[model samples]
Target chain A: MNYPNGSKQIPRSSQKLNSNETIFSNRGMTLEEDINATNDYYLDACLAVIHKKPTPVQIVKVDYPKRSAAVIKEGYFKQASTTDYNGVYRGKYVDFEAKETKNKTSFPLSNIHQHQVNHMKAVINQGGICFLIIRFAAFDETYLFQAHHLFEHWDNQFKGARKSIKYEQIRENGYFIPFAYQARVNYLSIVDQVYF
Target chain B: MNYPNGSKQIPRSSQKLNSNETIFSNRGMTLEEDINATNDYYLDACLAVIHKKPTPVQIVKVDYPKRSAAVIKEGYFKQASTTDYNGVYRGKYVDFEAKETKNKTSFPLSNIHQHQVNHMKAVINQGGICFLIIRFAAFDETYLFQAHHLFEHWDNQFKGARKSIKYEQIRENGYFIPFAYQARVNYLSIVDQVYF
Candidate 1:
């Protein structure tokens, strides 16, 4: 079966969602894959522009096999210097990080790195639209939290207010990113309501 | 010498440049290092905000040596889906790709792939700034050409234009990115000149 170049294929993999099905059993889709499909749909519909940050790798050895795709035999992961998913929407720069949490009640700071926090701050400083799309998978809910609010809590992280943001706090601070059949994570609608 | 963390010190390797040595003996500075230093200066001086796209990778195996850091034991290079550099400059969103060409006469279409071309077109369609920076190493000349021109040439590939863009044609259609001691590529100067 063609995976449709994105994670949406999980739903299309079979007519029924069952515990035994690999698609149903394996979290169905990762946050990254969902965002990828969402971006593809956005590109197709011309609503807004965004793309996932590339995986950071240090290429050490490349194998050139004739009549086949070049296989990277050896490489190392490099630290990312910026946040993933950035582009323009209605003339405003849109930048964000997508994260999923198994916890039903909160989003964890441990799930984020300091570098990512700093990168989002930098994006906000540049007159760009910056936010975080967080998914509480257990609750099957996603929230769009603006960078300023995220940093506010992050600033208080040293004081140990909360390691992860509570669902209640997120509900107060973030806009709900409604899911659609075509655009799975339609955060731009929230962006239009908030940043734009 | 410190080589961006985790890279072992190889005992004054022959390829190691003096602190001030230019890279490839043509661009005056390695693209990665110069982009970092330029970003540092940009952050310090509050100039237009721009950054090099993070290196892309696919992590296959990772060892959690300590909670603070994960040692990536195995990974592969994933094809990049976007340009090499992008950010917000003033109020405009900026995005671009940087490439070095050995061919002195023309830039080849083989250097770019379909996905990247689609990404650039999407960025432009969203009203963001997009372009490519080409370094003709033989002549030590750098040129910034808009993605539209690239798309046009690439589209014409089916109609049977030259497979590559001539250096003379590039000179006519593209702007020469000024060399700078600090910024190196200094492509933003040309952005201001052309776009602003």
Candidate 2:
């Protein structure tokens, strides 16, 4: 199994933890947390200016009480039209969506939406860096799969192809993103090697 | 007064409307709506992939019904750390905040926040195209003011300078954006001339 910081050994104290709990507790973070921490590191070092867009919520009603801030009384989550994380890196527009799946054999297409794919296509057409960060939690592995490569599978799915990308195929075509102490998901390294 | 689509005359039906009401009613849209429409035009034409980010909200409670979608019970608007709109344009990272002021004489510095300035500073340092779209509603004029020029005024406010940028200064330093039929706030025209 892959370990964070490239350390193969698990700490002795956590050896008794349940395997499922260990997936998160051992890593001390989820995929979202890891990416956020990495983005913070990138921002602090003046290396990039990436940020996760706020969750889209449709506000229906708001109450403005005297001497208090406005409070939303009714709201609902809205499906995002674009990727979750996006920003500028090295003068290029960078955009990507991060996902984590527990499946060991493959990454399912159901986790993504058509609009997000369409948005990624538009970004690519405009010459932006676009990709997906897929984490196979069962194996504790994360991969940076470029948008163009994903499009091939995404289109083939409608023509009697598998609804998911096999883990082996991902290993062959995607860049394995290594975890670091501070920058947990160092996807920019892959971007540097593949795009720059 | 400036007219949309470069027509000098106001429509006969709108001539009798109160001048203040005409600012929005006659224009039939706010600065935000105009910009959103312009972005849509750009997106439809595959010219750019810019979008205004969803409003930031701090959710406190949510209710999941038996069969219906989850609904947020309590939420509060959060001050955004970055600019309102950001996306890719001509293979470059573009970031900007749009603001409209009814004040005829100046654009107040108080309309902006320190954190946003810091965010814009970071974006500019990353070699991205950064600017502000300022709409002086009273004058029926909109201008594209580069972020660096705004930084000068933003910094001066702390150094015993006026807290507002005079209208004349903006007219002299900013590029006046023309209004089009479909692309109401055709700020990209100014972007092409100034940045490209």
Candidate 3:
């Protein structure tokens, strides 16, 4: 039930698509699950109000049954224009995307979208705390890489530079988020240390 | 193309389901559209980073082709647990729901869901700027009613109080958001006035 990172594995039998169970621990405690648990802990303690934006769906056809909620018979998942999670922390705007990579030496740029990069820039320009929660899944390590740092590497990609950030570079520039018991990923502590 | 409240109706011919057009002008520029335009203007000016949460959907079936993106074949609308619009403004967590009522005397409690009330309470308890943007369509009037003021009346509903908050009460407690040329609803200016 528990992973090496101290995250509890939620039972697959209890996974429900319509519920918060999307972030449950069945297929290895994904970086998302730990963050969700952390957000829940934060919410319970009145710490912050961060939430993962719901997956966007384009509804095409609907069946209006007799006296029942309308059922969408056809739809398509649409790519999100912003980051995965966003909210307020200590009276500051907090926004970030969580990405997992099994690659050992680097975090790939292709994992992120152009609009997401633009969104981070907008948030930063608006004086918000924006970053990337990069999980090197194979090594069980997570880092809070600031949006500006990511932007540097992203901009270099246009000049035929490396399409990924070296692990060494990330270790130097990014703040490591320690895996904790109740706090799970413990990224906000890094946010406080880095931003505050 | 302009509604009575100064919101511009997005041309129906240009509406796209998967686009932000869902929040665009139509139906005489619903309050949602005006707010969306204001949010867009704010984003462009690097003022704030507010966004309306996408409508939640419970996807039941999806199809994956060899070369294309996944397509959701069946889904159903899911009632949201939180407010419709939320983001960061002036380094503070800002959240609110926009509602329009034709009733001239009072804003009906039935217009809001119990879960939404609970969500607002949670945000306010955590030090967020929470409120309601209620528009009286018939009167061409709008008010930014704070969540705490709304909660007082909501709690009273269980103790045999009236099912609606009278317009006079809203006029006394809520800040009026003026319609502006470029920003549409100009709610953030009201936010700046009230909170900053």
Model number with the top TM-score:
2
TM-score of chain B of each: 0.80, 0.87, 0.84
TM-score of 2: 0.88
> Where in model 3 is the C-alpha error above 4 Å?
A1-27, B1-27
Model 1, position A126, has a per-residue lDDT of 73
Ranking by DockQ: 2, 3, 1
Error of 3 at B87 (Å): 1.7
**Model 3 lDDT tens row, A1-196:** 1122433432232334565444422238888988999999988888887888899887888999999989888787888988989877776778999999999899999999999999888788777789999988766777889999999999999999999999878878887676567788888777876788
State which candidate has the highest DockQ: 2
Model 3 docking grade: acceptable
Give the C-alpha miss distance for residue A101 in model 3, angstroms. 0.6
Candidate 2 C-alpha lDDT tens digits along A65-95: 9999999999999999999999999999999
Off by over 4 Å in 2: A1-26, B1-26
Interface RMSD of 3: 1.7
- The TM-score, computed over Cα atoms with residue i paired to residue i, of candidate 1 is 0.78
Winner of 1 and 2 under DockQ: 2
Better of 1 and 2 by lDDT: 2
Q: lDDT tens string, model 3, B50-132? A: 89998999888888988987878778888898898987776677889999998989999999999899778878776778899
